[model samples]
Target: MERDIGDLTIEIDRTLCIGSGSCVGLASETFEIDEQNLVRFQDETPDIDPERLKEACAVCPVDALRVYDGDEQIVP
Candidate 1:
């Protein structure tokens, strides 16, 4: 879906994240691997593509990636 929100928000369930790095690979500007090898947000306001974010969420090995718009609408 095409969205035009103020900004994008991404959430990762650390408990469910398997460190597969798919999200990081897809949206490196928004996602990254912490020292613990867990998925974490790279910055508070990182540049991200809505469609690529959705792709990252879709390819998450454990469904741990969630992307939301400024209106809190889930994108994938």
Candidate 2:
């Protein structure tokens, strides 16, 4: 799943997600864990700081979260 958050684009790869809650822990307002234990964007996400979002994505142990500034991938 992918969505535009400000000037950045966030992507969540369910197949790679291990449901560790790392991303959610870091950015609860921006991300959430589904019943299936996968990372997904929050419905009413506030204006997210790009760096915080990037950090959240980086915290994913399995690299299921991705942040893109235009065409460049900014997170692991």
Candidate 3:
């Protein structure tokens, strides 16, 4: 799944995700981990700082989360 939050573009690779709650735990407004432990979004525009947002994406254990700002990838 994909979502745009402020200037960041977040792409989640569901197949790669390990059901880690890191993203949701850091930015609840931007991400939610379901009962099945998959990630979902609260909204497109999350109320969070850019670096913090990137950190949320960075914390995903499987590298399932990708964050982009325009054409640049901010998170691995």
Candidate 4:
């Protein structure tokens, strides 16, 4: 799943996620761990800093989280 936040786009690959809370620890207001321990976006995500989002995505050990700027990927 993905969402456009300002000029950046954030995505979560549920299949690739390993139930790690790295992204949640960095951006709780933006990400959450579901009952199945998968990462998902908050229902009402606020305006998040692009760099913060990138940091959260980068912390994913399984590379399940991703951030993109237009057509270019900026995070793992």
Candidate 5:
């Protein structure tokens, strides 16, 4: 994906994430756990379904998820 939404990006703060699987359950194709069991980006900049992505963000229990657009803007 070309980050069509500007600097569109998603970041998981390992420190804040509690392995709740909310992000994974919501967007499995875009988020996953590595061999070390840490959540990692399936795509540094995912080719996302905007509405679904937003839902994933909203459902994250710890607010560990962040999505940024081209100008580093948050999309609702």
Candidate 6:
């Protein structure tokens, strides 16, 4: 599933995720790791600080997540 938070759009590639928990750690209100160890958003439009969202995306060791702020990429 894809989620939009402010100008940022977030998507998690479950197949590529390693259950790092980085997103949940940085923005607990916005993200969580399910029992399957996949990243799941709290909602379709999670309520979280933009800076914290970007920070979480930046820390993912694997490129399983993508967050875009407009046309610019917040995560690789």
TM-score of each prediction: 0.72, 0.95, 0.86, 0.96, 0.68, 0.85
Candidate 2 collision pairs:
none
Clashing pairs in 3: none
- RMSD for all candidates, in order, please: 4.9, 0.7, 1.5, 0.7, 4.0, 1.6
lDDT of 4 by residue, 1-76 (tens): 9998889999889999998899999999999999998999999989888788889999999999888999999887
Clashes of 6: 0
How well does model 3 score by local distance difference test?
0.84
The predicted structure with the larger TM-score, 3 or 6, is 3
lDDT of 6 by residue, 1-76 (tens): 6787887898888888899898788888887899898888875444678887888877889978798878788687
Distance from true position, residue 13, model 2, in Å?
Answer: 0.4
* Candidate 3 similarity to native, TM-score: 0.86
lDDT of each: 0.70, 0.90, 0.84, 0.91, 0.67, 0.82
Residue 31 miss distance in model 2 (angstroms) = 0.5
Give the number of the best model, judged by TM-score.
4
Candidate 2 residues 11-74, lDDT tens each? 8999999999988988999999999988888998899788888999998999998889999988
Lowest lDDT sum, 10 consecutive residues, model 4, at 45-54
- List, residue by residue over 2-76, the lDDT tens digit for candidate 3: 887777898989888888788988888788877778887775554689888899999999999999989998789
Model 4 residue 21 lDDT score: 96
Error of 1 at 18 (Å): 1.2
Error of 3 at 60 (Å): 0.7
Off by over 4 Å in 1: 1-8, 69-76
- lDDT score for residue 34 of model 5: 72
Clashing pairs in 5: 5-70, 6-70, 7-69, 7-70
> Compared with the true structure, what per-residue lDDT tens digits does model 1 show for residues 5-65?
2366556678887899988788777677898898877655345666777787678878787
Write model 5 residue lDDT over 1-76, tens digit each, in one string.
1223233565567777677777788888777777766666675654678778767866878777777765574633
